[model samples]
Target: MRIEIPAKKRLVHETRVPIRWGDMDAYRHVNNTIYFRFMEQARIEWISLLQQSTHTEDAGMLMVNGFCNFYQQLSYPGELIVKTYVGAIGRTSMDVYNAMFLTSAPEVKVAEGGATMVWVDLITDVATPWPEAILAGLR
Candidate 1:
């Protein structure tokens, strides 16, 4: 049986990442753990963009959960285009979705994943409300 996941409604950010030799496993394909790294890069880029545009202070976010589903194997000596999308938003947390595609074959999805990030106070390490400017930018 197959399950159909709904398409992302909007893409908030995207960035290109080159695959390094160290990213591969003994099987010569990108290690599954590396896919999470790709997602993290995209998420950081998204936050950086927001920070630049809004000029907001670094009130940080923490990832509470993450998941990835691999559809195809990625080899070294290539680059990937990582795309990020925002999903549900709450008082202090939000869902982020990511999709990775080979730069050479944009239409082919190599892997996809998501993470839940909660707004937090950097010093206190406690949950905090999302700033107005950042929230506006996210929407």
Candidate 2:
């Protein structure tokens, strides 16, 4: 049987994360919630790259929405290759997609997820337009 995995677009960033024992559940598999943490780790790295390139001190993005779908069970004593991609860009928001695959078999995806991030003004707590540098970087 063949499984239809979701197709991803251009890659924005990728990171490797080792599974910790505490990340597992009673079932001896990685907890579902930990998938989000992996995505967050990749997202932070992407943001850090952007910040370094733009040298901007402005407030970072706010995650307005997020989701994850599990395709296969992941166990500890392994590492994951988490990849992030740019999906869609709006005036003040952009969609970020993520996929997690076992390092042993990079072609086989274990989980997929995404999040909608909104640019916000840290001081006013209001949505704001994406900075030129940020938009360029995301493109």
Candidate 3:
């Protein structure tokens, strides 16, 4: 059976990153491993967006789980726009949806995925609930 995965245009925020020559593999395209770095960049932008608008004291949010699906090939020397958004906000975890697309070809979806991050106490290395202040910002 054929599965349908439609292109989504619900980017809450985006960051432009230039592809480096080192990102290419022997296949002459961006390496699959490099996608994770793109995801990391999007996640950092999402976190910073929250931090800047809110006054939360806790500055630590750790990724507990994440996965990605490579849809198409991305070559080096092209600009990649990493779009990110909060998919869901749970009691102690936040689900972030992210996608990487070519700046010149926005319709072409390069990759799409998500990450689940839990608010944690760095000193204790324990998860904690989403404070009301943070939740409000997420909404």
| Each model's backbone clash number | 0, 0, 0
Looking at model 1, the pairs that clash are: none
Give the poorly placed runs of model 2, Cα more than 4 Å off. 1-8, 52-59
Worst 10 residues of 3 by lDDT: 1-10
- lDDT tens digits, residues 12-130, model 1? 89899999999999999999999999999998888888864412366667898888989999999999999999888899998888989999999999888888888887777788898
Minimal lDDT window, size 10, model 1? 1-10
Clashes of 1: 0
TM-score, candidate 2, is 0.85
> Sorted by lDDT, highest first, which candidate order results?
1, 2, 3
> Clash number for model 2?
0
Better of 2 and 3 by TM-score: 2
Off by over 4 Å in 1: 1-8, 52-59, 122-125
lDDT (Cα, tens digit) per residue for candidate 3, span 1-139? 2223335434578898889999999999998888888888877777677664322355467788777888888887899989886665678887778878899998888888777888886666778887777777676
Which model is ahead, 1 or 3, in terms of lDDT?
1
* TM-score, prediction 3: 0.80
lDDT by residue (15-127, candidate 2, tens digit) is: 99999999999999999999999999998898888764322466657898888888999888999999998877889988888889999999998998888898887777888
